[model samples]
Target: MAIDPRGTDLKRLLSEDQGGPVVMLNLLRFDDGGREMYDQYAEALSTTFLPRYGGEVIYAGEGSTALVAEAGQEWDAVLLVRYPSRSAFSSMVADPEYQQVTGLRTKALTEAVLQVTTPWE
Candidate 1:
């Protein structure tokens, strides 16, 4: 859905300017967790974290079904949030409401990768 389908457009946008903090989260499982995992993140991010910081919940939910990989596979659910800054995200995670959801999410997923990346300057 771009001039290039290989994230070239995204990388180009990053190259030009990707101000502030962007976090990419990958939720993975062995086909066992059911719908609870997705539910928890949605609830927590929507009800708890997003409102607290005045930040943007850029993206969320299960990955695209259009593309499937040959070797392995994409994550079960993905989250892309843009916090005001790195510290805002850190503080939000430590906040009481967000902290409470950690237990729910912990029980929901078998594996996950929370990656924080600064866009290219």
Candidate 2:
């Protein structure tokens, strides 16, 4: 049910920084008619904020046929976003301009998960 990160969550995310690029795993589930709004958000994000902050969408796809998962674990879509570093991601989220457009994402999702992943050694 949590769509956005709270202050505490942000603090924890930064604290866990491993001092390198980070790939964020986004598991998204949309409410009724939410996908369209999310698409608007994605358009703005990809064109504006991402380039400004050294972030990029590595992959994005609609979820289908979960081979294995708990009853409530299926997602509607998944996104993999890479940031130059944790600080860059933090900065992007903190930007006032980006904040203005965040509502699109907020309004689009019923539930979401944003997890940071480190590259495999």
Candidate 3:
């Protein structure tokens, strides 16, 4: 997800998790559950990024939403990715090989938001 160019501080999100260099990525929502399409998107991501940059898909899938966020709109999936470093995470998104699959990812979503944060302990 694209960071908030207007307000986000990339450096802040870079230091949240303690176990290693972490990026607390929160995917807010999706248009619907396009399982078949999503699967294809997932495969492309795992194949390209994981093998080279090296990170784990720490979490995924939806859960309850609090009675906040305007109206409790729940997530379609939540992905927590722990890359080797902030630079590595940023680099993955820009790689020519990974860029080829960007369309796959965008096709499965209607609305999505992601924030890379260092995550406060």
Candidate 4:
């Protein structure tokens, strides 16, 4: 049910960094009217914060029929975001300007999974 990462989460993310880019997998379950709010946050992220922090949205899409998950496990949306490094992502989230718009994201989701992925060697 956590919509955003906490300070400890960010610290752990950095401490576990293996070096190089990191791709985050986001699974979102929205509240009523949440999609619109999330869109606003996404716009600011793509237009400003992402570029400023060397990150990019690798893929983003609404969830479709789940062929392999449990009945209650389907997410409303999914996003794959790639950051140059763990520190870059941490920095972006800590930016004051980004903090201003982050509330939109917080208000938009009822539950979320923000998982970090490392590419296979």
Best by TM-score: 4
Candidate 4 deviant stretches above 4 angstroms = none
Could you report the Cα RMSD, in angstroms, for every candidate shown?
Answer: 9.3, 0.8, 4.4, 0.6
> Can you rank all candidates by lDDT, best first?
4, 2, 3, 1
Model 4 RMSD, rounded to 1 decimal: 0.6
lDDT of 3 by residue, 17-72 (tens): 34456654756444465556667767887776766898778887775755566554
- lDDT per residue for candidate 1 within 40-75, as digits (tens), equals 666777776877875576776666673657645566
Whole-model lDDT for model 1 versus the true structure?
Answer: 0.59
Candidate 4 structure quality by residue, lDDT tens digits, 1-121: 6789999999999999999999999999999999999999999999999999999999999999999998889999999999999999999999999999999999999999999999999
Sorted on TM-score, best first, the list reads 4, 2, 3, 1
The TM-score values for the models, in the order shown, are 0.65, 0.97, 0.69, 0.98
lDDT of 2 by residue, 1-121 (tens): 6898877888998999889999999999999999999999999999999999999999999999988999989999999999999989999999999999999999999999999999999
Candidate 1 has what TM-score?
0.65
lDDT of 1 at 73: 54
Candidate 4 clashes between residue pairs 3 or more apart in a chain or in different chains: none
Number of the top lDDT candidate: 4
Per-candidate clashes, comma-separated: 0, 0, 4, 0
